[model samples]
Target chain A: MTEPTLQSDLNSFDLKAFLTEYGRLVVAAMEKRIARYPEESRVTQAMRHSLFAGGKRLRPILCMTSAEAVGGNKDHVMDVAAALEFIHTYSLIHDDLPALDDDDYRRGTPTCHKAFDEATAILAGDGLLTSAFEILSHAADDGLLPAEKVLTIIAGISHAAGCNGMILGQMLDIEGEHESLTREELEDIHNNKTGAMIEVSVFSGAYLGGGTPEQIAALDVYAKNVGLAFQVIDDILNVIGDPKVMGKAVGTDAELGKSTYPALMGLDGAQDFAERLINKALQAIVSFDNKCDPLRSIATYILTRSR
Target chain B: MTEPTLQSDLNSFDLKAFLTEYGRLVVAAMEKRIARYPEESRVTQAMRHSLFAGGKRLRPILCMTSAEAVGGNKDHVMDVAAALEFIHTYSLIHDDLPALDDDDYRRGTPTCHKAFDEATAILAGDGLLTSAFEILSHAADDGLLPAEKVLTIIAGISHAAGCNGMILGQMLDIEGEHESLTREELEDIHNNKTGAMIEVSVFSGAYLGGGTPEQIAALDVYAKNVGLAFQVIDDILNVIGDPKVMGKAVGTDAELGKSTYPALMGLDGAQDFAERLINKALQAIVSFDNKCDPLRSIATYILTRSR
Candidate 1:
């Protein structure tokens, strides 16, 4: 397939407006996907607490944008997009558990476990994770996607979030607390822990949009670069982000002796690394037309965002 | 289709031998499905810890038996069976967490949290849970089942084990600890908590085996009845069984001030209730011929087993 020439100019693209508009749509989809159970069910309550806890819906938006970038319909990818958000939300819930990061706050609200006890929080996370597959699988049932495609999407997300992916990353993150980690070790953790899901989220959307093998392969490059850049920016934010804006304590990573990009690369070096990663991400998608503006702008935003 | 004639006699059928043969096969499949990651991976270690801790393997066996009873190939259903065990194992890991049931021992060995750290235990459970779906969705990839059927099975199992099912039951269970529960309330808890996954396990097997709609409906009744009977018997065993044989502490439920069948119905009444449930379960599948003898015998054994 011939690549479409770029149409939207990066300089004029409003990243905040794109995020706000698409983020609301993703949240609405998630709200419908996550219905409140009757009788004020604590599990549902806890799930919704974090799910609606006002983060930038970056993963789902990235998914939708990836679909759009390939000239595929975004509507066709919404369920998968929402599924990505659910998986991300679940990870956050579990990460905040008393036995894990033990953070009491997230996205300007109390963490699920902090809000509704650890057991309920755990169940809430489990519920969201299970429901995510249910939602993705339902794409076929709803005639939103083919059964085979839905299965593919399910496999991608599950593997990305499963033991060898995000969970593996988490295990390393926990272990990293005990001792110093080399830059390679930290990158490995970021790749598996954060990068896998982010990569899957991007490519799954492209696949849903019926992107060609070449386009999908290109998106893989774009997603890896963007995913690593996202985490590096997060580490940078941990060092300089305002507590009020970030909605959690800063320097907790340093306080806990956790290895981070900033710690390993130094703050200025980490900032430069994030900039390079974003440029690499943009370069990966440059073959696509101006339709890639959302993705390009999002990559740039990831490097520049304060919270 | 005409129902097949009785091929096995309950009185003459050796339940132990059947369990032994099929159970070993199921365990081997589970072991293969749950390969350990290299370099003594702690997450996989914790997952293997509880996975191999030696439960009865009744769920997977029931899945296989249900396949056979429907004249479908049991080999076609093994992936789903392994997935069921993964889900069950994940639940056991999370349920034993210190923030939850807080038991140190499960299946005659240290719980995942006790064997590994609590954080590792949490990720291990999360990993196993994610892997279950990964394995289920892989059914199509392996040519073990059709993508559509696998999708249906995924939906059924995810829903049955998700918030509205097992997680919902757990929430109710936690709340139950705070107050005296009515018998009906307790039953509702048991049905969702214990019965949902059990019910889905049976029906998923039937679906995988290509059971007729009538047969599938019949198995639903069998599953629900058997599931409740299993729990009722669990309560009875807690009161009467030796801790060494039972492989976990007895009377811990009473110690925790949790309600049980015996607590609500007295020992004799609870035993009678279990007998009735099993009888009901048997009656539901009585027309299926002797091929169902494994299921019927399993229900009977639920009442009679020491552990």
Candidate 2:
């Protein structure tokens, strides 16, 4: 597959507008549905605080874009899209906990535990994680998707979030702290920790969109490249990007002694590597027509944006 | 429903033999599966250590008996039974962590974190929790049950394990620490933390056994009674029972200033309360034929046994 040539500049894409308009509605709906968990218990409230915290709903947007790219209804995919956001948000909450990364801030606000108690933060993470499947199961029962497809989506999401993927990555991340990590070690951690879920976002949407096996296979490749590129850029930004734009403490990697891509590959080499992966991502989407433009734009956008 | 007359006498039923044999096999299987995560890896090994440490497989046995009482195959329910165990084990791992109950010993061995480290213990809990759903999903695909039935079981299990149930109970339990809790407050915590999952076990087997709605409703009542009885007895044991048979430190409740039934009600009063709930549990299952005798016997066993 050849890389798709860009018709418009990356700066022309209005991600802020896309996220603010459609993303806000999607996230609000998600928070409302999740908040319906009986009485407004402390656990539920903590989960809502982290989940509804404002951010670019990139995962959900990817779900919607993948659905639209395949001529599926954006509205039909909305619940599943929101579910993806919950999973992402929950991971972030747990990752920031004292037992984990011990971060004080997330998305420009005090972390969940900082806002609440450590125990509340833990339960909040558990609540969000479980609620993701709850949302999917409820949507399946409501006929948002076919039972078989819903089963597939549920299984896929669980695998991505579970031991063989995200949890395993997290274990490695915790173990890797303050220790020198090999290049391969860094790749494994980021690939599973971040890449697996991102891949699930794109692949689940594609599968639910009724993409052909070949198309789904192609999207997997695209997703892996884009996921890695996303992380590489994140590492680069950690060192050089403005804290105002990132909404997180700058130089956290340096302070934490984290093994990041830029630390291992150097800034220039990491930039080149990200560009190559972005090119590969763009190339993977070449089988589609103009409908795939947004996907192509997203790949470029991953590297072009400062945050 | 009439009160279930104890089979001739208490000695006529031998729960020890039943639990001993099946519990051993269940623990062995669980240990083997957990060990597969790699012993060289300290994190996975810590999870395995706590998970595999010997404990009575009472919950899974309850599941198996319920399936058998409804004339379902025990082998068919193994996956569901294991899933039940996984959820229970995950709860224990999390509860024992320093951030939660901070217990040093569980099942006569060092807790997961005490055996390894805090971060490993956390990941282990997360891994086990996710594995429960993974096991259930795989069981469904392997033709253990129909897709619809599998979805029902998964939905039920998730609901019991999620915010409305176990997590909420845990949150309440944590909040209740060092505070004077009323009887109602203690009951609410146990009902969700312990009762919800116990109810799920019975419901899972019955649903898989193709039980009628009426039967399911009856079993739900039965489960609620036994679940409360189990906790009440636990509280009583903490006050007066032998720690050797209990296999863990006792009287820690008072030391930690945690609320308990025995703390609110005297030891004798707690025992009386437990007996009343045991009778109530038996009443709930009176409509079932002799096939349910094991469940009735188990209910009696719960209140009378040293453990």
Candidate 3:
């Protein structure tokens, strides 16, 4: 496939506005829903500390945008969008625990375990994970969607976030520490670690928004390519991006000796590879028309992001 | 309002036989379901290590028995029965982590973190947590139950297991350690920690088994009362039970300065309280016929067991 130039589309489609419009709805939903469980306790406080730590709200926006791509009201699937972010936030909390990645800070703030006691951080992660299912099963069943659709969404997210996907990837990533991995092996890890959730988020949005199966399938191809490209850019930016914009130190991936696309393909090779992936992702959904512009724009944004 | 004698029912029904019958089913279900995620990985091994450590399987049995009491086929709820145990096992693994309870041993075997590395154990716990929901949404939708029933059960389980229930209880329990807690405070922790899951286990079984609303409500009362009695008996056993039977050191609760019924109320007082609780649990289900004999027997067994 020929690589597509993105300078015009990037300038025309205001990615900031798209993110802000969906992000505001998600934040409001999270606040209103989270109030049901706060109970004025420390666990809720810890959950909120990590949750509101200025995340870019990328996953929920993807969900909402995918819904809109299907010519459905994005607000109808807002709860599920919020749920995707909850699942993401929970993974972040656990990933930053002392026993896992041992991250001291996230988004320029102390990580969950660093901000709270280790035990509380662990529970905060557990709480958020369980709450994701709670919100999906509870809020999604309030007559907005059919029960079958809700169950399908629940099953999808659970599978994407479970041992069959993210958890297995995490296990493999931990085992890969201090060891060299082939490009294929690194891709396998990233596909499970990152690609599965992203693909499911898009799938959920389309399905909940009443898209045809063929549409979801095409978006599936779109999501898979863009998700992996997003990870590649993350690795490249880690090595070469400005620290202030990234919200944390740079070159930490190299410091940890982690395997990455750049490590296997070189910086220029990785960037060219990411461009190729984005071009293919865009081609997969070319038939969707202006309704899918945000998805198309998001694909470009993922390729060009600094952080 | 009146204490009911259970000596006749306890003598008539064989608690050991009841446990063995349902325990065999749960073990088989766990073996079959857990196999789906094995992939021959260490995380799966760690999950199995903690899962098969041979706890009493009280929760699963309660679930099965409640289904039977409601005149539904017990096997229909077997997958959910297994899900309850998975949720329980994951909690035990997390509770035993170094940053939490920090116990090296559980049920006379090395804890998950001790048997494997800390990161693997944590991931194993996470894997099991996510897997429980996967099994529910994926397997429960296979034409056995209606989508509404399946969603209702999932919502109930999530509510009972989320911040509204088990996680909140765990947080309070940790904070209660090394500090004194009143009787009300201690009961609050046990209610959330132990009572919520137990009550929901019975509720899920009854609901899945097609019980009437009144029947499920009655069982909920029975479950709540029996659940507390079970924990009170646990406290009593910790202080005075034989180590050979209990399979771990006794009096550890006292060692940790943790508050318990026996610490707040005297040993004799706690025993009396447990007896009262069991009697009330039995009374709640008095209208049921011989189908509830196992439930009656289990309540008596909880109060009178040596361990």
DockQ, candidate 2, comes to 0.58
DockQ-derived CAPRI band for the predicted complex in model 1 = medium
Whole-model lDDT values for every prediction: 0.87, 0.80, 0.86
| TM-score of predicted chain B versus true chain B for each candidate | 0.95, 0.92, 0.95
Clashes of each: 5, 0, 0
Against the true structure, whose DockQ is highest?
3
lDDT of 1 by residue, B194-265 (tens): 899999989988898989999999999999999999899888888887888778999888888998889899
Per-residue C-alpha lDDT of model 1 across residues A102-186, encoded as one tens digit per residue = 9999988899988889999999899999999888878887676889988988888988998879999999899889689999999
Error of 3 at B51 (Å): 1.2
Give the number of the best model, judged by lDDT.
1
| Regions of model 3 farther than 4 Å from truth | A1-11, B1-8
| Segments in model 1 whose C-alpha atoms lie over 4 Å from true places | A1-9, B1-9, B36-39
Docking class for model 3 is medium
Q: Across residues B53-121, which tens digit of lDDT does each residue of candidate 3 receive?
A: 998898989999999999988878877888899999999999988899888878888889988988898
